[model samples]
Target: MPRNNDLNIILGDLKSLFSIAAVLMSAMVVSSLLFWELRSAAGFIAGMLVSLIIAAAIHSITPRSEALELKHAIIIAALAYLLIPAVSAIPYMISTGMSPVDAYFESISGWTSSGFTMLPAPDSIGHSMQLWRSVTQWIGAVGVILLMVTVLIRPGTSAYILYQSEARKERIRPSIRSTVRTIWKVYLALTIISFFILLLAGMPAWDALNVSMTAIGGGFTLYSDSIGHYDSLPIEIVLLPVMIAGAIPFAVLFMMFKLKLHTMIYDIQVRTFAGLIATGCLLLVAQNYFYFYNDLFSATRYSVFQLVSAITSTGLQTTDISGWSPTALLIMSIAMIIGGCAGSTSGGIKVAREIFLVNQIKLWLKKTLLSKKAVIVIRLGQHKVVEKTITEELNEATLISFLWILNILVSIMLLANILGPEVSLSNLIFEVCSAQGNCGLTTGIINPAISPLAKLIFIADMWMGRLEIVPVILLLRTVFRGFGR
Candidate 1:
């Protein structure tokens, strides 16, 4: 891989990316007009032009064909994530009086598909902004880099590097481009189906469109009350499968599309996540029934929806959990921490890493107990992982999960000092995990009134989680020590 060639190609690729983002924002221009929001339309126009200017400035270097190093991939991904939100927040600033920091925070939240919000009320944001946010969530969930590479970059070493830098890997096709195109098709198809289903379930057309777009992208509500706004069982039921689909790895869905159910069921990630969901739902139901809801039906209803929301990092809410017991909240926190499958829109440490950790641990224990001549391997279904891959997976998983938990703990301590005395220890734990896991369930601690430092802390957590921790570290290291090859 020629380092200079990699640099030129990635730069050229990013320039094309920002241009693409501006083109997509055109829909929001029309969206603003449809909603009769002249101010927002102007903001969208301004934002589009500014992004195009920035793209034009990125360079006219003709990309040379070469492989991109992991470091370059990380740098490009981290910078792209940071830069786009800064530009996209313009509409929020112009349409409403939200300060720069507030607007950027909201924009990044949508960009990460982590739906924690500072809005005091839904009416506070224009309907056009709401539509833009939902659209951004859909794009962000699909991944900024994946969208870019699929559109213009050809399949190659650089393409896969850019794609996986978004915290996703696993090819659904022979090449990165094909896989992404298939994923885009699947994602859009699901969004359309979800939109119609929500409409059928009694949501207004506009509301259905927004909710389905966000929900199918593993984002929560544009409304203040989240899923609770409707309180309709049919709506809840329809959304469960959509959220599940959103959180499922596109490869898994691709396998399903190919009718490979037998292989999927035996996959370690599938089994482990299913076990986690079942246990979480049961524990939550018992706690809610015995302590809060008092009725079996009511407990089960909230338990299923909230548990799926937490595990999928979807953040849709049917009821508040503020009054729930510490035990109940802990269960929800655990679900959020585990989150959905790797290569999915949802966040947290991911199901693939969790199973990898468990398998490695089992392999270690078995090795210590077994005879010297014994043969052993960690198997996922009919496949055996090679030792080198196992070592890499373990190293990556342990490192990222450690940094992830560290970020959560630090945020908790900071918030404990900043928030009210009445804010319990459990709620603080829940809040930080929600932010860092990119799981947006809240205990009411997030607000525009919160101190800037607190807001910044949550903002940083979302960025790190969405980038999967390592890239942020790589970027910070580059800033201090200078860029490394």
Candidate 2:
């Protein structure tokens, strides 16, 4: 007795859900093969069958539409992104026997590319599960935007709206699909290049593969100590550049690929991103020289690695940053929050927004210095930004930044109430920054033995951070509206 339109909506939702399940099943199959775990293989098969059944049911029940509305697209994207991670966590729970919350935390962390893990050590988890973790980040890095552009978006305003909502406003090509394919090509090429470099740097094949995936901010390390497990300067050097590359905007990479060196070098956002990295590195190096490690080379190595890792949101660490001075830790925390450029795998507020906000502030100062009637326009790169655009950008950036602070403060209080006040506020802030930035580096607070509630909080933070909060909010709104009913 349901209307045909209502049935179609339900069917579309089911299809999207099944699609996510299929992705999880595929990952599971890969994990099963890697570990040669029969039980996991069975799980993968069962998952696939279930997904196919749902797909079949949806296909049978509903008719296809020529185009989808913006609301429909947002709903589909939100559900797909969230459900993929949730379903993917099942295998981790089964393999590691981690409590449901811990497993969800790990899965969300991986999918969000946050890299923070509750696992005790590298050897503690099976090879297959670790690989699965890496895969989740790698997939999530490209994101639902890439998928929509490739498979859904066509010419016109709908595509534009979807692109903006996806937080990838920068277009690399005339066609959205072409842009996505180019981005994917660059991403995969970098992955391959990183893999070979790591192998040459003396990592074993499996280790190289895992580290290569993680080096680009995919946030899955094969070992517990992360890049530190290799203990090789060569490996660190190899990874450092790759992490930087990951942080660079994909549109810039496409320009570089087209041999437009000026576009790559002269880009305002890229230049600012590079400048921030250099500044952060210098500060950390100075801190290390004065307090941590007096050795010049050791200090520079750790400083560069941590800076690049945080800036890129890669979260792979060569040293325990918890032992660093409070000043150094604070600097790194801020770097993590700033993150990389737009149109990249890295997360956080992003360098582009930071540049925009700074420029807006400068314009305001200029106006204040001039007569009250004077007009001022913000400038970024070669373009003069409109007042409306600047205002919106500032408002969005401020809201997100304030929300992040609030979340961090609440999390710290929760942790303090549970873990005691002995834990330094600085360390708590560092962990919060790491998780929210999707940097994956930790202050040793996230452990297998932590309280379940704490783990859930971190997981929620990672999920919110990765999606940049909007999609999750929309998903919640949809649930409250009872569309599923």
Candidate 3:
């Protein structure tokens, strides 16, 4: 009876998810229609129909039992990541003429905010498709679950579970629903302001809007060369703060609404992130100036923008990553692994995790010097962290970091086996790390020509990275348990 009830709740949650997806698809259909892409519009509308039908069927069959729990939320969140992309791929398959695998890969990339593209010439894909890509990333940036929480789900345990399951660790309000709504509003305001700034920076209106969406999500590009297409310092300067904002905790930004500038400045995660970026920028500038480019000005120009992009996990490249020196690549790779803050659109192990790991390491060494009889408590940020809390966090961070490194090795091996001797080891690592970190920077390896197996591996990496691995792990355990039973 318990198993049956859990199944019913899962189905009901999925029905709600699909219902929201239908609305999203309807908007896409309208956008396509506005662009006179009748076939593409029809494809999107068809997907909406399919979503609605499935949602309706689930609603009609499933009993109206609110047997919701954290497990149900975890399952629903995992399934949403899996299934939403499947439905989203329909337009790509029908209108873009991509294979099912490639279409699914593109959808997953956009939905995960990973920004890896299978399409070689994104500009050729038409305006609606471009807008669709941006829209997908924008929705994904905040997460589909968070969207449901703000606009659909009521303020309750279910909303809270869904929020945490999506790896959202920050709340700006007491109520989960109110918190999500506030964040969404902040997200919208930032995106709009960025759009106009880009426009004033001389970008076309459509491109501005699209880039604003992608940049705010820390997601993909419309052009093949990414932000490099503009080649305007003013444009990159305008985008810099937007990308930084996307990488920051929404709660910090919310505090700014109340004019808590001191909190924003003194926040540990923000301070650490800013310091890392500054130090990395200096290192890369010197390295590039001495070894890669003779002109210090030219080196600083490229180094600062790329470092900001990488550290933010925005992945909007202005310079060619393939040509960067090994030292520069290493610096950028470390930044990608550390990523942005705890509750940001950017992905990685995250700055918060790294902060915990570093502080814990310091505490360990201090204990080695202290007497056994002494009592010591470590402080993180402004709060006193107990030994047990530090130990648990250290364990969690170590496990997640291990998984990240393990997957990087696995991906490198897979790419070597599949793509052969032509692909350099460093380039493969860069590509793999970019995928797993949900950073879109690439070494010119990602494209349609890659094997379906490689694309699938990247898709899995993006999914795991975005959820920070726990929900996905729990989901797998749930599946295995069901099978065992």
Q: Which candidate has the top score in TM-score?
A: 3
TM-score of each: 0.94, 0.90, 0.96
Shift of residue 67 alpha carbon in model 2, Å: 5.3
| C-alpha RMSD values across all candidates | 2.5, 3.2, 1.8
Residue-level error in angstroms, candidate 1, position 221 = 2.2
Per-residue lDDT tens digits of candidate 2, residues 216-285? 8766687778888878998888888899989999888878878888997778889999899989999999
Best by lDDT: 3
Off by over 4 Å in 3: 483-485
Residue 354 of candidate 1: its Cα lDDT?
88
TM-score of 2: 0.90
| Candidate 3 per-residue lDDT over residues 1-485, each given as its tens digit | 12667889888888888999899989988889889998789779888998999999998889976757887888888889999999989888888889999999999999888888888889999888898899899999889888878777454887888888887767788888888889988899889999999999999998898999999755578788899988999998898899889998999988886788988777999999999889999999998998888898789988898888888888899888788777788888888888998888888899988988898888888899999877779887778888888888888888888888887788788888988899877777888888888888888888888888888888898888787777777788877675225
Q: Model 1 over residues 1-485: C-alpha lDDT tens digits?
A: 32456457557666777888799778889988998999999889988998898887776545544556767778889888888888899888888878888888888988888888777675557888888888888888888888887877555877788878887778888988888899998788878989999999888898898898888654547577888888899999998888888878877777776788765687667777788888899999999999999999999999899889999988888888888888998999988888888877788899888887888888888789999777777786569876567778999899888988888888888888888687899988988888887878887888788888888889998888888888888777766675544
Give the whole-model CA lDDT for all candidates, comma-separated.
0.82, 0.77, 0.85
Considering TM-score, where higher is better, how would the candidates rank from best to worst?
3, 1, 2
